[model samples]
Target: GKGSHSNDVGAIQADLPVPSDVLIYYYEVTVKDAGERGVIAVGFADVHFRLSRQPGWEPNSYGYHADDGNKFHNSGKGEEYGPPFVQGDTVGAGIHLENREIFFTKNGKKLGAAFQNVKATLFPTIGLHSQNEHVEINFGAKPFQFDIEGMIAEEREQRQLAVLRSRIPAHACHDIVCSYLKHYGYAETLLSFDQGAYTEQVAKDEETPQAFGLEDRKRVRNMLFEGDVEGVRQLLIGKQPQLAQLQEDPLAVGGSGSGHKGAPGEPFGDAFFHLSVQQFIELLRQDKIGEAVEHARSSLSTFQGRSHQHDQHLQDVLALLAYKSPGQSPVGQFMSTAQREKVADIINTAMLESSATASASGSGSGSGTSAGAGGG
Candidate 1:
């Protein structure tokens, strides 16, 4: 946050854990810098692969060979194993299942790795750690590729959250909701918190799975570049919360950028939570309150910018929360005992008694509700 890009130990260690049984084919990274340069250093800082919790806490081989294969990606090998990485580039490395053969590629060239048979195992997960700044993980592909945009958007939030928590003063009571949402991409919406007067708009439709794929995203992202109001409106109207969350940028904290580029000085859809809560509010308005409530309840579990799975989850939670006999706060009625305690400690004292009573009655294991709403 303070200086030009440099190696961050925390960021490197915060690797995402991939579940077992699934294999990640490639990783796409969006290089960010003064020059938009993409860089992947084999041996030096290409990609880090660690067995989720492999025995003896052993570390897997680096995708590039620091000693044997090639340090700066010598292209003479004619695509033997993996290719070398360069600045401003998004490279892919194959973490082979058998023989643990690691191959590298940059613009589709051959670079090599040091070890083989380094079994790609984890503590029930795989973490695609990028030593470089813009690495993204991709498991499935072709007719059904991974959620690339969502992945990067999410990692960006993680990086930003690390920035926010580290820079801001540590209060006795943390405004984690803001920080959490901020991390989730609601920086601008949260920033709007300071500006007292404004009306919030609800997105009309739920985002479909196909819309999140590469093709649809390409159209949507390009449209923002064209700045077409009607097109943007139609696209955003009624889009799912998950897709909407993708629009928020964690780096932004919010001001006046309203109306796509709303009111002068206002924040753009830079804050992720703005999209999320907007989706949240929509579900509530549609009488699908429980889905949104449950979403907040299992906040940490569902990552922002991944797939519509979490959105579906959000829908269900919001719907369920709506059923709480009115005046029955979603937080009070449906939240887990632990989640209730979390809210109790931070929001209000009255929450304590209500939460306790709700806990005793076990009101959260909601019945009659199929998933997120009045079926919204």
Candidate 2:
């Protein structure tokens, strides 16, 4: 059925309340039946405004005219706004509330902003002049061809980032990045970080309490990789001065100097047993049966009665001796490259734990170290 412009206004029978949250409100119009150069307008107007002329012809209304693709508002038709609407062409009108602007699209292609600073409450509207000028109005009951939600989210994300920028100091954030770069052996990145625009703001004295510096971590990690247990011991003692005493007299066997009261054999006890086991295993791998036996008797024997894990590991190391080709037996699994890697991991983890314990003690006296799993 064709809607004739009885008095210039031909509003759709339905009206919708536009939501405030959405960045833009969209309406699509499709011309179905019309005369040559037929005039059809699609836009928004006050619900009470007579749809006498095109939506924008009245003071509180806005419209995109299809005849010349001109914009109309407050009884005045403005410049070209969109492609002329012919039969079967869809014209979409969008009301952007954020900027108080309105725009039109011809066949889904934006024709640019049509009006600015629109503040009046309006309803979806359309107008036609010809008797057979038929048009369909879609108030978004179906999915839009454009990704409006994605566009809105992207805009909102920018706004949120702006808010964050105003709150967090730039230097503090970059310092974390500096730490990460050093951690991953990105020396050039670390150097470049110092040359960044934030260099002046990042004072050297403003050190974020890093438990283990990257250089120290890398040095210790390399020592362990090369089966340098003595070097690992020296590095740990140097980083954690207290460890020097703990190494001489392990905490588990009532070493009185340790600050905590029986803080569980978790830290020092675990590190001692694992390192001693690795030394014993290394001796066996070198086929120094006599030295390996002496190491087990002197270092590994203390852990046998300390914990079940220690006892189990000790037994496994002893089992390695039963095979004529000790490196070829099931117990020889511990002699594989994987086992050597585990020794490095144990040292790294101990360094982290010791650093964390020291920091959490609130002494705030030593360098900070972190534990991270190394990728082989």
Whole-model lDDT for model 2 versus the true structure? 0.66
Best by lDDT: 2
Error of 2 at 217 (Å): 33
Off by over 4 Å in 1: 1-10, 13-25, 32-61, 65-84, 109-114, 120-376
lDDT of 1 by residue, 1-376 (tens): 2212322111232244333343323343323321222222332121343333111122442434211224222232222343334444444444433334444445434344434554544212222223434444333442223343333443443443344224232231135545665788987877774242212111111221121223333344444333332343344333322223334432221222322221111122232332343344434444665675664555423334534664564454455444544325554333332332222122122212222222222322232211111111
lDDT of 2 by residue, 217-273 (tens): 567656755777777777665554555555555553223444554242236556766
Q: Where does model 2 exceed 4 Å of error? A: 1-9, 167-376
Error of model 1, residue 245, in angstroms = 56
Which residue pairs in model 2 clash with each other? 8-52, 9-51, 9-52, 57-75, 69-81, 210-368, 211-368, 211-369, 212-368, 212-369
- Provide TM-scores for the models: 0.23, 0.44
